[model samples]
Target chain A: MAALALPILALGALTACGAEEETGTPASDTTRTLKVGYISGTSLGPAFVADALGCYRDEGLTIEFEPIKNPADAIAFLATDKLDAYVGSPSAGMFNQVAKGAELKMVASLGSVNTPEGEAAPSGLFGAKSIKSVEELKGKRVALLGSVGSATSYLLGKSLEAGGLSFGDVELVTLGSSDMVPALKNGGVEAALLFAPETQKAIDQDVAHALVDSKKAYGSSTTAGIIFGTKLLKTERATGVSFLKANACAAKRFEGDWRKDAEIVKMLADFMKVPENTISGGGLYAFDSSLAINEGTLTEMQEMFVKVEGILTYTDLLPADKLVDDTLRAEAVGAA
Target chain B: MSPVTRDQEAVESTGTWRTIAPGPAELDPRGYARRRTLMERGLAILVPVALISLWQLLAGAGVLESNYFPPPSDIAASWADLLASGVYQESVLASLSRIVSGYLLGTSCAVALGMVIGSVRLLRVALEPTISALYTVPKLAILPLLLLIFGLGETSKILLVALTCFFVVLINTIDAVSSVSPRYHDVGRSCGASRWSTLVHITLPAALPQTLTGMRIASGLAVIVIVGAEFVAADAGLGFLVWNSWNLGVPEHMYVGIVSISLIGVIVGLVLRGVEWLLTPWNR
Candidate 1:
């Protein structure tokens, strides 16, 4: 008993030490470093552009980019104050955390379907050769690029509605973006909701074709964005505002035929570690220069998740004001 | 009377060995041992309970972040909710089905192959090195290839568990069969026993104990590998529940899944120990 109790007591002491570490030092007024968690994807083009163009440097901030596996992980890190901000999609995790009183808020939009003409959809549902349309996906396996509660599931849910089917109509399988195209090719899934480069890959491989265009399926929907944790939300609001200002500066470069810009493409390629052609060839996400968040999309996401069941803990939708804070983006927009 | 006084009186009075019936006060010879066993069991239960209570106290007092390490009460509530929803039962059943199928298939095949290789010098010389090489390859590393071959279904997860159990049981079985005394086989042969008779009567009983121990170890490995495979491959198992709950930002549900997995591991260990006891009575 003493043996077991000793280790447990040691663990308690370690936890107490961690609590002390969590009470981090205050940031200086002149310049502050923000620990940012992000996933490498085309949707985060603005951040890559910001880094390459020295937008963050201009704002008197040092940005540390930590690559994370999932937006959920980012949410957890942000809530725990391990990350100052996260560049990822707003998912059930974010909403649930906010509902549970985690001091975090989605401050800016990263990617949306609202774009000018002739640009490819940022993400869409692709079907195998045998599956030509969403209607053909009935009773078939449809793979999602992330977990069931991820932002991609919103796109998938909306796309399925076009065929008069719900998320329940087809079997939903969760797979990583890298595995999406292969799963489609191998009949592991009849269709899949693919993001950016993977969507381009499915078309290039000739194994799958577009079943639903995300842009057409849900117009002006913003699911991916920048979210601020407690540090940015409460303690260091100016730093958060400056972070958004930097993002707004980068978003200016994302306008009309941005992928055609070799420098921008090369910068993104270097940051994301993919080839230049891979960044240049694929559809780039539409980003708002002012970082205008779509609260309606967020509310709708919660409702859809609630309808799906087992994703959201609460039955009722969390109000939009509780989930988002537009003041940071508004300040940045005014500054820009 | 006190046991020490009774013993002294008997020794001084008799001066010779004599059997005496136990007195009423000393009716149960194992009373002290029984009390010791109960005390050990009580301590076993008490330690975990004490640790959990400490965790609850810390979490409730806001020292440990409730978001990350929720109080045990919250976890218990989530466990009850999951049970009421039947999600917990379904996840357990899914994982158990895969584990059982994989364990039986892997162990039976391993024992059969091990017996053949161990009994024959030429086969052992040809196969042991290759088997050893394959054994050293991590089972989880082959998951992607298994998914590719088995197509992201239950088959891949089951195969992963089977592969994990296979190597452990195979090595132990080969060693156990090989190390059976040559004198026992010699005695069987001199008594005009056939090859089958020598194997069944002499070699089988000698190797049974060690093989059962290997089987017990393999059972635990099977559970671990199946849970890991479920994390990547399957959509309805305990690993998926844990991952999904975490993704959904429900720490309570994740804890429920984790606790369920631990319980399953403990139950599997106990069940295997019972099987070992029943199968190898001589070891008992």
Candidate 2:
């Protein structure tokens, strides 16, 4: 029995090793699964919309929306086997990852601030009662989230520059944007970059007030969008194209007067686990109508990453065209 | 001391000395007074070199992906670049300062409280169960709460480290004290030694080995808690460097951070071991 057990155990180990991620066509080919990691915040509205409206199902693609606590985590897993796609900004973090040869491809536009059709950018510079505007942040501590090479810092920095103050002017504190509300309340940080429900939560709690919206300085920006890992983009692009089509449909439905729709409001409220009334009110993120990944905005983002953050040298800059593939978006739009 | 006495002392060594081993391979070779053999030294260097060479080989052969797992050469280059920039030194200094301060405070408080608890039946009965229960709770769970209480500055990081260290030291110290044997106490009483004298001379000496082991454990915990806390919220630390590097897809820089943390653990462990050698010479 002991001699016989070795081969059996080896077979079992081989089977376990073979049980990797889903690849090739499934036995049931009708429903192709795309594991998309996204934050629960409003920035990832289109994915939520697609999941709710059954757009993914309609296109024969099952988008498993892995609601990541922080979208920043998805960036790390974007190139690996863990995640297929993620909704996040074109920050230095993402750019550097691509430069490092993480097989991540920018596929679709989630939305940006420029064409804030029905959605308005939910994130803004919030601060305690003492600070009122960007100018007041000079010499005061300001908490920024999304890591060191974050676009939020650039947004804040640009705004500060307009007021004759640079990044060095303020004492920068690093903390999660979600935790910033309570931090502001208890005076952990003087100012913070908060988004969506957390911002509303702070405002309702009467501890923090909106100081400056980044859109004013950065202008209508393509904050984040859908990105594909090397595996799906290389082997299963048909599924990738289908996933983008679903996003486009979701974006169109969301752009077509979603604020007034009680169903969408309730869906978003339940999805976000916030008060139903919070969805009905303002402070919702405006997604782009076309769901188009703009090359210019990405270049602008890369430039800021290089000049503002010094994350990458000018020589290391991978052009926006190389980073993004417009063919998938073009196909998705045509199919939609 | 006489040569005879010296030989006897060497025979009954505490093992603190890294004396050369007598084996078939090294029996013929001349041994250093108290040093590892060339064979040992060669093996020591060989393992890591072989592993790293294999890593580089796999990477060059396309078996190991350089995207996630970088080559040692790349890691070395990044490590050198970072150190040359001076930020590495500043971050290491900041983290080390926090770790030392927190470990000292936590261990000191634990030793005091543990001694009292072990000495008094009432204190032990009242507090021991509660402490043991609290020790099982994950220290990371209280990080956000610590932030709320202590704010997002260095205070929260220090407090979290101290909190984690407190449990390990307290539990070990209590166990060490309780296990020192009641016979020692009885002997002290017969000798007409005062309670303080009994504790200081007899019980404390008996418990020193266990307590030092606790300190060593607490030292490692301090490194872990500080790194984790820094990863959650820190602008300057090896953890921050690793995290930011990982996010930015710089494998070389990430590996540098990885190496730095391992180096911290090694240095801290060696320091604790050296302290133990001083405090508990016989046990060594």
Candidate 3:
């Protein structure tokens, strides 16, 4: 028993020493606030740019990021009006909520796929050395962003169609895109549905190779977007418009050889806590200065999700135009 | 002796335990006792019935957003839908299998280690602090690291479940074993019991009640962690069903998963109580 004392004390010391918050809280004022729920990722580059540049502040809006960890939380918060806006994936849940007569609207694009210039979707299914071809993915485990039959799943389904396989052909594991690199290295999965920065980083490391480009399947797509809850639409239309305008300007700033501008890159780097190199040319979530929602892509994704979740019939489907409010987008487009 | 101490004694003794009746003024008159108990039981069930009815009414009246806050009828329809698709069966099987396997694995190791340490005071003091500290760290925080080591398969989830169950079982086992009256050890020795016999017949039975209590608590904790584990990387389970349904924006299916877990907790807890009743008949 006496011999046991030392080890226990030592172990206590070890676990107790390093437990604390890793990042500091953001500063905000009580006057004129907009709470935007978003996940932490490079996909939010436009918002990050707007946030860092004080664009919202210029318009007398204090931005509060809700920092959503799960996609579901975003939906609930938006539905309950706890969030004014949320940037996230276009899932069946978002569409179904609209169909059920929730006043939430897709206000502006959050992230999009390849452009007319031929840059494929920056995210895709990537394979290990052992997985040389799409055909080889059969029966192998794959990591995907979000959940099954999501945007990531749609991409996987496309590749599977080409490879004579299906979503059921391989074992699918749900993991975040950030976890994909280590997941790939540790054989957590044989392949992963990777998005930008991570996809580029993986390829640069030569650990995983692209198997299917989502951009190749759904060319000119809006993957996720900034959604305005009814509370914001009704109570603070100007704030919502201001949010889009700020983001549009940020998009233009990013679009304008902002990569070469040291101060802007440094500001983004400091705020996002990434190396300037990673953020500078970060093909993060390629956003057009227009901040426009892809009308057709939303309709296509909605139809696909309605069938996939098995909750809705084809007859229950509506066109994407019903869900998006072009009011703020037009304002941002003209003003920015 | 006071009524409370009498009940306590009955619980600890080999004699059959009986609950003491309240004094004359405390309960209803003799003639009305049966009716009183009936009224009490009915009242106990009334709250839940009323609440559920109100929830249903509010939802049907569109007081609640059916899209996010789905009605009970919609949730029931979802349960039927899940059953029709066989997703319900698969998810239940996956969750139950994981919970049972992890709880057993965790509790066994904890009980064995707890016995060794609890019997020795210095070991208890030395280890308990570390155990307490580790327990305070949220289990999900380490899941990514676990995924790195064990990958995103069943192994990582099972390991997390085990880890979650371990601390609760360990701390309880320590307390239970330490609480065993020294007089019981004296009695075992007087019977010419071997060291092993003293531990098995005397030490173990003395700690059995609390150990069972710990197991009950750990099982609940195991369910929570299993759901959390599934939330991270699993493709199938009640947790996966809830998370996937929520992500898909099907509130009814999410409610189905939530209700299923609540039922499982009640069922498992009742089963544990039944096991205790059967095993400790002398303690009533």
True contacts kept of each: 0.58, 0.53, 0.74
User: Candidates sorted by lDDT, descending order?
Assistant: 1, 3, 2
Q: Could you tell me which residue pairs clash in candidate 3?
A: A93-B248, A93-B249, A110-A225, A121-A215
* Cα lDDT, all candidates: 0.85, 0.75, 0.77
TM-score for predicted model 1 compared with the true structure: 0.89
How well is each residue in A32-62 modelled by candidate 3, as lDDT tens digits?
Answer: 6778888665556778668778887776568
lDDT score, residue A160, model 2?
Answer: 66
TM-score of each: 0.89, 0.84, 0.82
Candidate 1 on A1-336: residue-level lDDT in tens?
A: 999999989986674454334434332333567899997777778976797899999887889999999788899999999999999888898888888889888899986766677767878888999987899888999998766788889989889988888888899887877888999998999999887778778888999988876677877788778988988887777678879999999988887778888988988989989899988888777777988998999988887889876899888788888889999899889967
Docking class of 3: acceptable
Clashes in model 1: which pairs?
A: none
Residue-level lDDT for A206 in candidate 3 = 86
Q: Which candidate leads the pack in TM-score?
A: 1
lDDT of 3 by residue, B120-168 (tens): 9999989989999997888878888887887666787888888888888
The residue pairs found clashing in candidate 2 are A114-A220, A119-A286, A120-A286, B14-B284
Evaluation by TM-score, superior candidate among 1 and 3: 1
**Per-residue accuracy of model 1 over B89-123 as CA lDDT, tens digit each:** 99999999999999998999899988888899899
- Between prediction 2 and prediction 3, the one with superior lDDT is 3
Q: What is the lDDT of residue B132 in candidate 2?
A: 90
